[model samples]
Target chain A: MVIAAIAIARIHDLFAVVMLTGIFSLLGAAAYVVMDAVDVAFTEAAVGAGASTVLMLGTLALTTSKERPAPAKNVISALIVVVFTGVVLIYGTLDMPIYGDPMAPIHHHVADHYLGKSSAEVGLPNVVTSVLASYRSYDTLGETFVIFTAAAGVLAILGQSRLPRRHHDQEDSEKGMVSSPEKSKGAST
Target chain B: MEQFPGLIPYWVIMVLMMMGLYIVIAHGNLIKKIVGLNVFQVSVFLLYITMAKVEGGTAPILAEGIKLYSNPLPHVLILTAIVVGVATTALGLALVVRIHNAYGTIEDEEIDKLEDQT
Candidate 1:
């Protein structure tokens, strides 16, 4: 995954970068599986690798595929900021419980209760599903609305009205390769 | 060295997160920035899932003989976050397309130059 990220940063071709991003997501999903996070792995594969790649390709179709070289000053400043933040984060992690420790604070209270009672209370085999669909249904509903709003926003921005209209003169200048404006107008309508 | 071994995953997480942040801050391309944002977000997802893991635990599906289960709460939370992340990515891409159509270029410095001229 780290190697893929490095390649993505160095590659200027937008298409290859998008492909590498998909590979990175897939690698992350595999790592999730190794950590026993099946549900997260599933979503990461489906949403991260699948949907995100398609969206990025659509954007690539409309935009230039080569990245302009960043200013050297910007790169230096960004490196400074990232290194500072990473050091602080590593410092903070020094106090965290060791990885996979059952006695970790997060596993003690609500997680234990869910593991103990979810089968009886929710009567479902998958405790993740019950917690998502039953115990925390309101949060899920909010998430659904967020998705709806995002879709609506995209549609509003990329709607038919926003699409560039092919004019008759523009078509004539292009050796009539494009269909007549009347035909395009008819098809659009 | 023993303490260091336990902290390996966290160090990996920090490196991955910083890589994403560096890309987002240094790159001028709009789509590249979005891709960087996705990488950053996925690292955060990994951090949550890593914390939710239990040693020698299986998936949180209730089974006849399974005694240990990983925490389901973080999985559920991250699931919603993943969906939200994709939705936001879609919206961001759509905005990028619009920006390209309007400005004739998607580079941040060029866009700033254009704005200054106007």
Candidate 2:
């Protein structure tokens, strides 16, 4: 996994990054397998490692791969924030339960209800799916909205483009392509 | 055979994860940062998968006399996460490519500069 990730990080080539990302996803899927969640692992392996990486690579084909030089002014501030975050995470570790301890509050809590009763209540062998799709349908809808929001955010950030104004004659000649006010009026007639 | 309890694997995973995170944080290049992020994610994936193993759990399938089955649920969840991760990575890369086309640089700093100029 480390090897795959490093392959992704150090490479200047966008195609290589996409490939490494796919590998990283595959590794994640494998990890999920070990976690005893077979269906989730399968979905992750197929969708995350396969389709998404390919889509990204296709997108990369339409763009450039070179990076710009970093400005020096904000370096110190960035470093400070990163260092502080790292320190906080390290401090947080002191309070974390040991890996896979059955007695951990996380494991002992509400997870049991989902694992034990979700199948009976939701009538689905895959409790996670049942909970996500049924018991928590509203949450799932909200999640979809969140995804839509992300798409909107990206579009809002990068989608504005300048289009050259067209003369009446030019617009008329390319009748099928560009719809002008005159054409709309004609169509209405 | 120094069996230091919970030391080796944890340190090993952490080191890899930190290195990956460092690359993503330090690199200004879009491609490089993605790579670093991939590395960081992979290390965590390994840790989670490794945690799933029990001392003598058998493969999670039922055969004639197989007494134990390793948990299958984790595998399923990981699979889905992997799929989602792939999709996100793909979309991100696609955006990077588009950004490169629009801004003429794959480096984050350069892209920012171009945007600022506009």
Candidate 3:
């Protein structure tokens, strides 16, 4: 399902693709919830589906929707990636736990404590939250920094020193809207 | 046979998740992708709520006559998530309108050309 969605994202139009990205995040959130990690699901739904989509659309509005046609040579790289991923997954499955078996090592080990005694140990009812905010607090903090770094990177790459003037103003009024001071700086002074 | 109810909910959640993902990826319209994303997020909310439910659970709130409460934590978390999702969608749509104004077209490819020139 993830692979199909990824493919569609690239093949479809920009608007459709953005919507699909939201769907992808939502599905991922649901997958986390079904796996009994409610906190992760909540974060995924909010950050992935909500905030990220909004940010992407905002950027999209500033740019065009249509993607450049793929260079023929890029197809080779894509093929190599697909084959490598498939092989890795097939090999990984050899060591995976069978679907939802209660006796699997995953179900029997240290996780059992969080399920059985988290409320008493941490004085919190939500085991997932306890782990995220307490046990693995540093990891969560690291993730926040990672997100911050990404935002900084985007700003560095795409930040405009000055806003673009709207040519649409002239299209609407038909009188040819006079350029503002900023525009005069760039054009006929 | 009793376990059937437990299993069907999981399957339905998975199906919905997949469908939402497909729309997000396959569709080209900006608005359509947002809708697809909404559907995807809703499915996850449903899955979490389902897991929190016990066989014969009721509301988590305490009352003199009430007992057998199902988990309320998941529901509370989902409510907050929903609000965030809506806010994100609104922001995205607003950006699209702005983009349409700056560039003559909403198509993604045309935007690239304009970007290339500058």
Number of the predicted model whose TM-score against the real structure is largest: 1
Best by DockQ: 1
Chain A TM-score values for every predicted structure, listed in order = 0.85, 0.68, 0.71
Task: Show where candidate 1 strays beyond 4 Å.
Answer: A160-189
lDDT agreement with native, every candidate: 0.83, 0.53, 0.52
DockQ (C-alpha based) per candidate is: 0.58, 0.23, 0.09
Stretches of model 3 off by over 4 angstroms after superposition? A2-12, A152-189, B1-118
Give per-residue CA lDDT, model 2, range A68-110, as digits (tens): 4334544455456556655665454545444454454544355
Candidate 2 vs candidate 3: the DockQ winner is: 2
TM-score of each: 0.91, 0.65, 0.52
Question: Which of candidates 2 and 3 reaches a greater TM-score?
Answer: 2
Against the true structure, whose lDDT is highest?
1
Error of 3 at A14 (Å): 1.3
Q: Model 1, range A88-151, lDDT digits (tens) per residue?
A: 9999989888899888999997999898999999999999999999999999999988877776
Flag regions of model 2 displaced more than 4 Å: A66-91, A151-189, B1-4, B7-17, B34-98, B112-118
Best first by lDDT, ranked: 1, 2, 3
Interface RMS deviation of candidate 2: 9.2
Q: For all candidates, what are the clash counts? A: 0, 40, 24
Query: For model 3, how does the per-residue alpha-carbon lDDT over A14-35 read when each residue is reduced to its tens digit?
Result: 6566666677677767665555
Q: fnat, candidate 1? A: 0.76
